[model samples]
Target chain A: MKKHIRKTAVLSILTTVALVLSYVEAILPPIWAAVPGIKIGLPNIIIIFILYKTGLKDAITVSVIRLFLVALLFGNAMTLLYSAAGAILSIALMTLCKKINLFSMVGVSIVGGVAHNLGQILVAMAIFETSQIGYYMLVLAVTGTIAGVFVGIAASIILKRFEKIKI
Target chain B: MKNNNSQKNQKLRNDIILAVVIVFIAAAGLLLFVLTKQEGSTVAVKIDGVVTDTYPLSENREVSIKTGENDENINILTIKDGKASISEADCPDKICVETRAVSFVGETIVCLPHKIVIEITNEKTDDQIDVAV
Candidate 1:
């Protein structure tokens, strides 16, 4: 029971950290003016960390909670829809990549990042009922891969440091 | 220790392969778009997956598209000099407004928050082209 409580506490703290990171990214100026919706996906660092350190179930639970909370605090229904879709797709891909284990944490993170962007684009195409918007995916794929590398490196570093401490 | 070292090297190779594949696909898709693109003469405004209005690119006009409850959401589309753009919008993210004016076929200005899209199309008929000539 105590171990379970500790696990829950750690997950909650991680969720809060992810939420704060989302707020920080929101306050920061656009990384690139040419791409209006392009983001570094700071919260992804936490998600990747959880995926590597904890189990997939914990990672998913924390991700969902963070998504809902961030939407409530900083976004609306429309944002939630896009985010939920992206999060689901990203997590699923990350899990599959990790299961294969042919690549490192960075590889899994990259898969997650690229999948997240693809999910948003797919949702956009569905909503607009036009395949023309798929053109944006070219730009998104480049950005997503770059951002994934950054997030992956950050997560791996954190995981290494936490290896000494038992959670 | 040797096994671990080889595994790490293999993982690095795989990562490179994955990144290359993704980038290649994106580049190929972009090439396809470029090859098929043509100068468009019309802008189609789509709301909720339906084309609500169509405007000629040759004409200079401003269209205010009102949507949502009580028509609270507004996206002001401006067309001039054979290019279409969203000059103003009330959406949370003004991505559409920031997008460069589009004159080529398949170019789009999308306002996801407002469910609005401005797409360029080359739908001019032979008769219309002859008349212009």
Candidate 2:
């Protein structure tokens, strides 16, 4: 029982960290690169950590909680719906990739990033009531690929260090 | 030991396959962009959702549509007498702003959070105007 409680507590802390990082990223000025809608996806580090250390269920729980709390704090009610959709999609894709074990952490992370962006685009299309934005998907996919690889690499290093630690 | 080596070889082969797939997709996208390249002076801006205001671009009477609520405004800049290129959106990502002017048969400006999309058609051939909703 104590071990379970400890694990839950750790998960909560990680979720909080993810929420904070997401909020920070939201406030930062967007960096316009060759592709549009590209972001650093800083919160993904926490998600990847949870997936590696705990399990998929725990990681998903953390993602949902962090997304909800962040939306409540910084976004409108409608924005919550979009964010939730994107978060769920990203988590699902990453978990699936992890199950396959074909790609390393980096590969999984790239999949997650691409999935998240695509999910967001879908929601945007729904809201904007136009299909013209579909063109942007190509650019987004390319950008997501790059960002996913970077975040995945970062998470792998962190996970590797955590594994080596005796604590 | 033999099984472990074979497993490693399998993993390498899979990685190679995935890499090839990604490259192929990227190439396809680039090819599409190149093929669809258009040269026109017309610019049109579609204001997703509601159009709160229209601002003039330069002094030539070219107008840009500004959409969204007061809190989150997406401004599209249209050149060539209100035909293309919109900039300045209040969305966090600013992806729409980075998009170039749409001068081809099919081009669009999309604001996902606001449920807004601005699309350009051939104006001469396409008839149905349906918003994704």
Q: Candidate 2's residue-wise lDDT over A25-129, tens digit each?
A: 888876663345668798998898788877888888888888779878998777787777778899898888889878777777777887888888787777665
Which candidate gets the maximum DockQ versus the true structure?
Answer: 1
Model 2 segments beyond 4 Å from truth?
A33-35, A164-167, B1-20, B37-77, B87-99, B111-115, B127-133
User: Which run of 10 residues does model 2 chain B get worst, by summed lDDT?
Assistant: B124-133
C-alpha lDDT values of all predictions:
0.88, 0.68
Docking class of predicted structure 2: acceptable
Taking candidate 1, what TM-score does its chain B reach relative to the real chain B?
Answer: 0.88
Interface root mean square deviation per prediction: 1.4, 3.3
Per-residue CA lDDT of candidate 1, range B3-110, in tens? 999998999889888888888998898888889888988999999889999899999999999989899999999999999989999987787888889999888888
User: Per-residue lDDT for A104-126 in model 1, tens only?
Assistant: 88888889888898888888888
lDDT of the structure predicted as candidate 1: 0.88
For all candidates listed, what's the TM-score of chain B alone?
Answer: 0.88, 0.58
> Of the candidates shown, which would achieve the greatest TM-score relative to the real structure?
1
